[model samples]
Structure formats: structure tokens, C-alpha cells
Target: MTKFPVLHEEQVREFYYNVEFVEDDSLHTWVGNKSLYLDEELLEKILELPDMHCAGVQKKIMKGEYQLLFEFVNKVLLPRTEKHIMASSTDLFVMESLCKFEPLNLLALVLEHMYKTVIEHKGKHRMG
Candidate 1:
């Protein structure tokens, strides 16, 4: 279980807008699911970890302190993702590429999730 850092709207937009194309497709599909991209239950578990705390992660990404992002990507996000994608497939290269895509996809996933989360949370708060 691992918790992702809180990202601002501007940062999410920046990351989404700056994405590179993989062939004709926008590589956007690599990061899908606005709600619970990296296992919401697991994310919740990670968040509850005593050692964890929220940080302004997007700023660090913009500043190119990718190690922090990499840690979360490699250790927490990628492994779980790989298990699903690589389960039936045997191609190491594709698996490797997918693993690489994990971090970038993570950014995409987080941004999309954040956007949806804000909208949903606000909707609930306002309605309730």
C-alpha cells in the first residue's frame, strides 16, 4: 500500500497537457480510471500509515525531483499494475515498457483522479 501526494489543479493540467503521444494515440489510455486508479482501498491503507504525510508533490515533479515520484511509482504503483498486465503475457520488453509507463501513467491517473475527486466531493458536500 502506498499513498500518492496531493496535486493541485494547475499541476494536473500541466502534466496532462504536456503528455507525449505514443504513435497516434495520446498515451492517455495508459492512465485510466478517475476513481481509484491505484487501488483506493490500498491508497486509503497507505494514507493511514503512521510514517506518511501529505506533501505538495506536483511542485517537486515540476522542479524535476523525480526520485520521490519514482519511489512511489516503482515501489507501490508499478508492481500491482504489472501483475495484471503481465500475468498472461510473456514479453519482457512490453512488460518493461509498461513498467516505465507506470510513472507517467501515475501522473496522469492522479490528475484525473484528483479532478474527479474534487468534483464528486464538492457535489456531495454541497448537496448534503
Candidate 2:
């Protein structure tokens, strides 16, 4: 079984607060005006991959593999969404923009949020 990473909440909060969003008119419009949410099924699929544990995932993101990461994100996470479809051809472009501008900051934010979300869901199920 794959385990989600246990990120330090304080560090994650600091990163979340400090990360800057660069102005990109194209990507901004492509992503739409809503907050990006990861798909549960995509998260599960990633967790199931033998080589896709938390540390490895983080390493890949930090190593500038945003294209691959977003490939999975677009295919499994955001597929079928209007925003995703609209930006399908421009996935690489947007990812490059994010990598060049935000670096690993955005990835860290997403991973931190995803980990907390999974934990909260598991807790709810156990309690229910």
C-alpha cells in the first residue's frame, strides 16, 4: 500500500502564504476563475502506482517534471472539465509557465492540500 506524505503543517502553511502567482493572461483565463481541485480517482490511481509514493512524487515535481505531472493531472484529474478541455493543447505551455514562474511552490501547495484532504476523508469514514 502507498502512503501519503506527512508534510509539516507549519512549513506547508508558510509556503502556501509565501508562494507568488505570476500574471499570465493566457493561463489565468485557461484555468478559469475557480480554485483547482484534484480528482479523487486520479489521486487513488497515483497512490496505487508502485513507484509513486510521496517522496518520489515530490522529487519529480521539484526536478521540473511539471509536464508529466500535469499530464496525469489533465488525464485523470481534470479530464472532462471544461477548463481542461479548453487547455488541452496548451498543457505544455501552461506547465512551462508554472515551472518557470512558480517552480515547486505550486506543487508543494497541492501536495500538502491533497494529503490533508485524504486524511480528513479517512477520518470521517472511520468515525462514521
Candidate 3:
């Protein structure tokens, strides 16, 4: 399991203040005149799916070998309803995009996930 650091209040403030919306909504920071955008390192660590850079990923997807990809997206990325047994459009998109080595906007990822979660439980509200 990949561990995310617990951001303190100050850290969140620093990030909000320092962050920039660069290309395609990707988060960036300009430090010492250097523009920095985190790439696939974080996602790769999260997945730990071996042979990602190999030439066979697209082939596997094409063959409908979705078990591996589905596991990562459903279990690791979004631990929602266990009934999420098969990959949704969003899950497939992540697999396809990341497989193609496309740039990832981490901020967009978080926002999209939050939006989906809210949508999924839109009317199931319960007061404590």
C-alpha cells in the first residue's frame, strides 16, 4: 500500500498559496525559478503493477484482460462499493491514459473522484 503524507494545516496553506494551475489542470510549483510538475512517479508507486513500461499493456487491454487493471483502480484507487466488480468508463480511462504515458493532473484526479463519490450517493443522506 502506498502511503500518502498527512498534510498539516500549514502544509495545505502552503500548497494552496504556492500551487499553480499549469497545463491541463496539472498542479505545479515554481521554486527558485524552476517549474515543477510531478509526473507518473506517484501513480506508479501506488499501483506497483510490474512491466507497465513493457509493450504488452495495450495488448492486454485489447484482449479484455481487465482483471489486473480493474483491481488497481477499484481496490487501490477507489475503494467504493464492492459491487464495483467490473471497470467503469472512468476506470478504463485511467488504465488507457496511464498506459499511454499521458500527463496526469493530480488535482483533476482528486476533484473527479470527489465529484463521482458525491454523485454516487447524492440522495442517500442520513443525519447523525
Best by TM-score: 3
Q: List the residue pairs that clash in candidate 2.
A: none
Ranking by TM-score: 3, 2, 1
Question: In angstroms, what RMSD does candidate 1 have relative to the true structure?
Answer: 17.9
Once superposed on the true structure, which residue ranges of model 1 sit more than 4 Å away at CA?
1-103, 125-128
User: Using alpha carbons, what is the TM-score of model 1?
Assistant: 0.19
Candidate lDDT scores, in order, read 0.36, 0.39, 0.52
**What would you estimate as the lDDT of candidate 2?**
0.39
**Per-residue lDDT of model 1, residues 84-105, tens digit only:** 2112121222233455663122
For all candidates, the clash counts are 0, 0, 0
RMSD after CA superposition, every candidate: 17.9, 16.4, 10.2
User: What stretches of model 2 exceed 4 Å from their correct place?
Assistant: 1-67, 72-78, 81-87, 102-128
Residues 61-106 of candidate 3: C-alpha lDDT, one tens digit per residue: 4444566766776778766764655465566666776677875444
lDDT of 2 by residue, 1-128 (tens): 99998878655444333333333211111122333333334444555422111112232333345646576656764343233322332344335555566333233334444434333343442321
lDDT of 1 at 120: 38
Which stretches of candidate 3 lie above 4 Å from their native place? 1-65, 122-128
